[model samples]
Target: MTTGKEYVTAVFEKVKAQNSHEAEFLQAVEEVFDSLIPVFDKYPEYIEENILERLVEPERVLSFRVPWVDDRGQVQVNRGYRVQFSSAIGPYKGGLRFHPSVNQSIIKFLGFEQIFKNSLTGLPIGGGKGGSNFDPKGKSDNEVMRFTQSFMTELQKYIGPDIDVPAGDIGVGGREIGYLFGQYKRLNGYKNGVLTGKGLTYGGSLARTEATGYGAVYFAEQMLKARGEGFAGKTAVVSGSGNVAIYATEKLHALGAKVIAVSDSSGYVYDKEGINLETLKQLKEVERARIVKYTEHHPNAVFTPAGGDSIWTIKADLAFPCATQNELNAADAKALVANGVIAVTEGANMPSTLEAIEIFLEAGVSFGPAKAANAGGVAVSALEMAQNSQRTPWTFEEVDSKLYQIMKAIYTNSAAAAKEFGEEGNLVLGANIAGFLKVAQAMSAQGVV
Candidate 1:
């Protein structure tokens, strides 16, 4: 007999009571639940069936110990985790992150986000994520290989092409994917569909590397066009020097936006004359050097040691938060809005805190939530799975074109859902509602387990 808001509050309270220590997971769940108030009101059957209760809980959670040998002939141990949040729509698909910060909370948060992000792509993908507390930083190639090999030795047992597919996330890249795929192949034979983000020599999809960054830019362009604005002749700032930030900058520059800054964990490189993509690729991608090294190559560019959300202080027409979760906060959002940022595109999962999102919306910024704006990576990941299943590979341009179309469709769907739900232009709510309705319907059709 509870009202819609009351039901949402009750479900969220139950989640929090059960997972009091999981801050990241709680935040993600709360955000989605907040957006479902309208949906719950419209479809009271969802409440009667306890869909929120079941949806909030992960279907499967696997935890294991990953022990590997370092180059020094010493044994190291790390915790590995995988959570299959849902499989209502299709196979559980997500990424494996390798970082010291990888924990149950982070993985659960990511897996939970992946459910909506994947559903928003209009792809038959569910939600799953796996990772380890294994930090790849400063590790030798052999060390990384040994760790990934050991990690996959166990992980391969649970995943298959038609079941759960894990790609790469933070601290996981082509090198790690190559190592993990090799181990999976060594154990289970040549299954290209077991993972995405593989090297070109293998079954990796073309443009998979650039899909996330490029997709964010593509989604941002749609947002701007809707507002009768565009990216031409505008200043922008992108955080992180990783794959997402780099390619997002590339796409932004291609759309006639001058991206003046890009950062790494150590610091941010600000180039008033515009960031040199070639130099950046060489330093971060090729050499794997620090952002400070950019200053060494281009003396004109300034390298500030202030990393994280500090990049928001730089005035620009657009803001691309391609960094880590909660990197941008209320103060950072205030700074970006005060500086007249036109759009804020998320290229990273949950990069902006809840308060930061509110600030952007209140200031009339064209905000692209991560679930809608960043679905490109997984959309192409599904495409890669399709190619792998058919034993055919797509050309770079072909994949890029498809990625653009998918991003456009995601934008349209999210905007329409928001408008229909009486929160026009509120993409956060729109994305959550649109994605949830799809999975909820699927789950309902399948009946309760």
Candidate 2:
């Protein structure tokens, strides 16, 4: 009686009305929903079962107050959230993002995206995301430890090895995870499987730090291969200086692509001779300094402060957006397209806007969606969980090899789904359909929960 497009429109309209304030979540939903029309049209059963409606709604949402004392003995209060989105596949698995920009909508968006991203990995993990609005930047080790301990004191009750496994994201990294794990162990004993991204001295997986960035580059390499090309001698512009961007640059360099620029919250630094990897690691990972300091080490490079146009202005053969959501906008997309960007692979969740994505598609630039491109991080996180469960650690080469294979598989799966859907080479549609189909089938088999 109703067309698939109509069904999608109706469901999305209802979601928008119910979550009027969740702009980021709504955008993510709309993007995924747009890709499902072909799927729903071919299989009317999905509409009859109202699978889209169920998928959009999280299974559980926990909101709590997190109060901790600052170094000044002043008390600080922050909002914490956990959105357990889906569990049809396996235990709820996702990352914990801690940043000043974190909010309900952002967490929900990340969680919703995670559902499919996890499914795409061919792993049994489901989707969920938790985080706090506390900024870890500019905080001392003591201050960070206090905040993570207090935050975990409450979060520990809701998470476990086989329950919900949370990894690091944004502001949450090795230091934060260590502190959180210490608190968890203090409360529930040594449960290494309760969290991923732990230190190697504990239960951390080898190559986990490099998985996301390497995976993205690996996926992008596949995209280029699909076009009868490779990353050799290509110029690259990567956004963000965090774990994702840093590792992505490393991989790009290894793959024979010259990563000419990298960015952070302060803005981006451009080096015509290609970024110095060790210097970047010292400034970001070790010293935890802003990107502006990059020029101090490489005075030959130029540092552009934030607040003008974002990182897309850098002309390059490839563009990797490894920063926060919507960091690449319409103007940035236009600039990249104008600059002849051969491929755009996402290393962050929804880094590109809908308009930007459309522009890329229309321009015939090969695009790797975030769910498939950045899934390497979570894939390695899942491996960490497996190692923790088995009480064994894998070597870095072993982990890196597994990561490469998984990333290649993701690209093949996404591309196959796109070709099957008659939208050949449209990875956005392919990734959404491929991931949704997996989760939707699992949900269907289990029946209404």
Candidate 3:
């Protein structure tokens, strides 16, 4: 019988051997494997088929060139990638990101993470991710529209409602989604469910924008409840001013927690009295100004451009890493713990490094892994798919209530799986084992495809 650590070690060595540049990927895989020891022991067949090895590698990787003319009428080319990591449980489903950091390695890591996240949500969507190195920040409306249309020209061939569906992520938010969906419709003539995160008039679900952040809080709420505490009266430090970070701050505030700081790639803003939501919305949504400008209105607040590390020194009861993968490291985790942080939840995929996760676990801080915590976004994406298939729309109240129920169920199922494997109170193990079992069983049922 192979010990779980031994199996994990072997898999890590194999992945490293395949691609030495995948250090970040290997590290993320190791964290999940370390948490899966008890599950491996319980389900010995996972060892027989070498599931860990298969899980780390994606099933398909698509790379293509996106060529578009800028306002100068000059043709500039960008590389795009899509990694359909797994379809064990259902069709391929995940978001399409548009950030300069996108690459095959990053997309592979994200898609691999998505497989478990989608499973944890108990949704019948598989795992996949697509994105380009296109930066939409400074591009004019026409430039962005043309680029998006060119991107979908090739992407539409690979995605469909019953095959692979894509939504929005990071730089690919509502505006980007609208462009991508419009291009898809132009190419394929309006297939309703081929994409999610659409404009509500085009079959998008309500409460989708708030799902991830709200879900993170809901999952954190569960973790707190287990420890005889809750979100009421806690102080939180959330990093990022994007959709995820903004909505997370909103939900935290709504739950009676004081969100003192919110950041952007430009910098972070600190308001001891808690951030003003309307000001933040104007900064992020309307003006698209840097977060540093936030301090102009509130002279008492501090702005730090270094983001995660910039605000780590501030004290808070909870920390939500909502920016990007591995944004919070060992030092940051130690800072939060030292400052009396009782809980940490990931609003971004693999936002916490292995060392940071270990630090939190050792400190007895309640941690909610990304798979269970950020599954809300994809859960609501699945909801959108349901609405599209039914040819109907749900009221905001109905959708919000369903989203809450889904989040609670995801938390309960992940927690129960953790306890069942004798790793009670360790959500890392629970989320991995629970998500793995679902995908593994689906793989078995599908018979080696």
Candidate 4:
């Protein structure tokens, strides 16, 4: 009898051999594959159909060049990528990231993760991600506009609301999405649903900005309730001062938790008296300044440079790693556990390392994986699409209520799947198996497209 670990190792070895240079993609694959071993034991038909091999490969990969002129009249060039990883369930749906670090590996990894994340949403959407290597920081509004127009000039041919819908992620936000949508409309003409995360004046859905962050807190609340605990009086340390972290902190406060810390790429801010939400929003969303500037406004707060994994050392009852990929590792996990942290929820995609996840599971800490916890953003994106299709809009309260129900459903489904698979309460396994089974069954029914 082949042990689960041995089977997982075999599948992972094949993935590594094929994608030696795609480290990020391989990591995502390994994580999902590792969790599917128990399911494979129960359903040999999945192996017989070679679903692992099929799911690992993408349905399509598109790459193009983007050329635009800066304020200095100098022509600049960047690479753009769109990986439509899976459409087994519905049209391709994901966000478009714009950062200097954007690469094929990162895009593929994000797209691959989207498959399961979309599945967990219980919505009729598939997995896809698109982005470019163009860094939008420090660029004037016109410069950014010209670049987005150029990027959309090439991208407009491949995307539509029913085909692939792109939203905001990381460096891409309302400003960037606005530029992209404007250009797309100019070229394609009046397609409101083709892009998500739009301004409220347009087809953008309410509660979209707060979806991922709010959904994470809602999931955390459910996790706590499972253990006879709640967010009241708990201290939280949330890394990253971006939309996810900021709104997550806001929701935490509303739920009776004090978020003491939040970070950015440059460093993190620790406020012993609790983080001021308005101050954080001004720095991050309005001024667009570095997180270190937070201390200048709140004299009582202390700003510390971000050494590798230093944010994990902060003691708190709950930790939300809303930073980038692999930000939390085994060492960080150890520190969190040592600090008596009870729950760790991810607001960013794949923010926790596999080793760190192992540490949390071993210590019996409630860990909310990124796919399930962060699906709120994409879930609401789907809602925006529905509104566009119907030519109607939903109120903030209505959208938020629906988001809450979706998050609750995700937690319940994941928990039920985990219990069914003998890893009771292991969200990692629960999410992977539940999401995998959905996509796998869809793929099998579709006849291996």
TM-score of each: 0.99, 0.99, 0.97, 0.98
- Candidate 1 global Cα RMSD: 1.0
273 Cα displacement, candidate 3 (Å) = 0.9
Q: Write one digit per residue (lDDT tens) for candidate 4, span 363-432.
A: 9999999999999999999999999999999999999999999999999999999999899999999998
Q: What is the lDDT of residue 412 in candidate 3?
A: 88
- Residue 270 in model 3: lDDT: 91
| lDDT-superior candidate, 1 or 4 | 1
lDDT of 3 by residue, 1-449 (tens): 78776777788788888978866566666777777777667777877787777777788889999999999899989998888889788889999989998887788788888999999888899999999999998998889998999999999889999989999998998888999999998889989899999998888999999889888998898999999988888999998888888889999899999999988777788999999999999989999999999999999998877734567778999999899988888888888989999999999989898889889989999999998999989999999999999998998789878888888888888889888878788898888888888988877666655
Instruction: Supply candidate 1's per-residue lDDT for 319.
Output: 95
lDDT of each: 0.94, 0.93, 0.87, 0.93
Error of 3 at 342 (Å): 0.2
Please state the error at residue 94 of candidate 4 in Å.
0.6
Give the range where candidate 1 is weakest over 10 consecutive residues by summed lDDT. Answer: 302-311
lDDT of 2 by residue, 188-253 (tens): 999999999999999999999999999999999999998999989999999999999999999999
User: Mind giving the per-residue lDDT tens digits that candidate 1 earns over 1-449?
Assistant: 66789899999999999999999999999888999998989999999988999999999999999999999999999999999999999999999999998999999999999999999999899999999999999999999999999999889889999889999999999999999999999999998998999888899899999999999999999999999988889999999989999999999999899999999889898899999999999998999998999988899998889644488999999999998999999999999998999899999999999999999989899999999998889999999999999999999999999999999999999999999999999999999999999999998899997
